[model samples]
Target: AGGQGEGNGLTQLPCPLGLVVDQLGTIYVTDDGNHRIMRWPKGATQGSVIVGGNGGGGQSNQLNGPVGLSFDRHDCDHCEENTDWVLASEPLSHSFQTVKLTHHLLWTVDTNQ
Candidate 1:
């Protein structure tokens, strides 16, 4: 088995804060340094901008010093498929937020908000 710079087919991603693999083999990228999570779906060439917050002196729906991320599609814990969401930790925000994945991927429902 080969991966990451294996053949130019895939390369090492930067600041991968989180990781997940679906049955379809799609790659979810969380560029923590860049303050965004991009999708590198299977057989894709470029990363698709999925989620990101103000990367500067700001705090928005994207993230605020976002450190962790995860994706779940099932209805669970105050959420459903309609509210399938991503979970991330923000030190600046001093809390965590459950983000809507089915929506704009930016819709977040924060317990501390």
Candidate 2:
């Protein structure tokens, strides 16, 4: 959906590799080039960063080229970064939960329960 040069603007996507549409028609995209996840509300002209966007690194608050995304039953987005960690975020709450992986296995542990 973006042809412009790599940018954080709603219409500019540097290297979007994965996307998912929620039941509310809100689109979530994995902005790999920008190292962030973007949330674009249906019919909106711009999207906001729901996760990452703090530059690429190994920091807890940063993402380096996220490539895949999915949503769990609780509406939390799970993203697989270009590292050994998986990042989860609730767009509405703007909170983050990170999990490290071993042997490239993907699993969810609901700490809230």
Candidate 3:
């Protein structure tokens, strides 16, 4: 139920939650029901798993019912300076996590966003 024609590829993602588009027209989808995030490139047959182990809420880098995801760096201070950061929200844990794409830094925010 997004738009009229494009983006909807007839492949229904159960409990489809998070949504984001990269530069390559790849669609990032957080399939909540499956407890994992998936990505589907434009004109792809199926999605590829990106996160999770189909488990409940925990603090072990596992996803559980993740609702929202944002990769936009327009407002991030150091993002424009070539910092590859991604913000993902986990409502179940009442926290947000910042992931660095280039470097291996995982920072979790306890405050709600």
- Largest TM-score belongs to which candidate? 2
- Once fitted onto the true fold, the runs of candidate 3 whose alpha carbons sit more than 4 angstroms away are 1-12, 59-61, 74-113
Worst window of 10 by summed lDDT in candidate 3: 74-83
lDDT of 1 at 64: 40
- Candidate 1, overall lDDT? 0.44
State the C-alpha lDDT per candidate. Answer: 0.44, 0.80, 0.49
Rank all candidate structures by their TM-score, best first, as comma-separated numbers.
2, 3, 1
> Model 2, stretches more than 4 Å misplaced?
92-94, 107-113
Encode model 3's per-residue lDDT on 1-113: one tens digit a residue.
22323232335465776676765676777656555566677777766665553463443345556565545333121111112434454422434454545553433232424
- What digit string (tens of lDDT, one per residue) describes model 2 on residues 1-113? 56667777768889999898887899899999889888888888778877788899877778889988887778888888877767867866768777767557555454543
Query: TM-score of model 2 relative to the true fold?
Result: 0.79
Q: All candidates: CA RMSD in angstroms?
A: 11.8, 4.5, 11.8
Clashing pairs in 1: 52-62, 53-62, 53-63, 75-80
Highest lDDT against the true fold, candidate = 2
For residues 4-68, write the lDDT of model 1, one tens digit per residue.
53221224444555555544676665555555555566787665555553362233344444444
Backbone clashes for every candidate come to: 4, 0, 0
Model 3's number of clashes is 0
Write down the TM-score of every candidate.
0.48, 0.79, 0.52
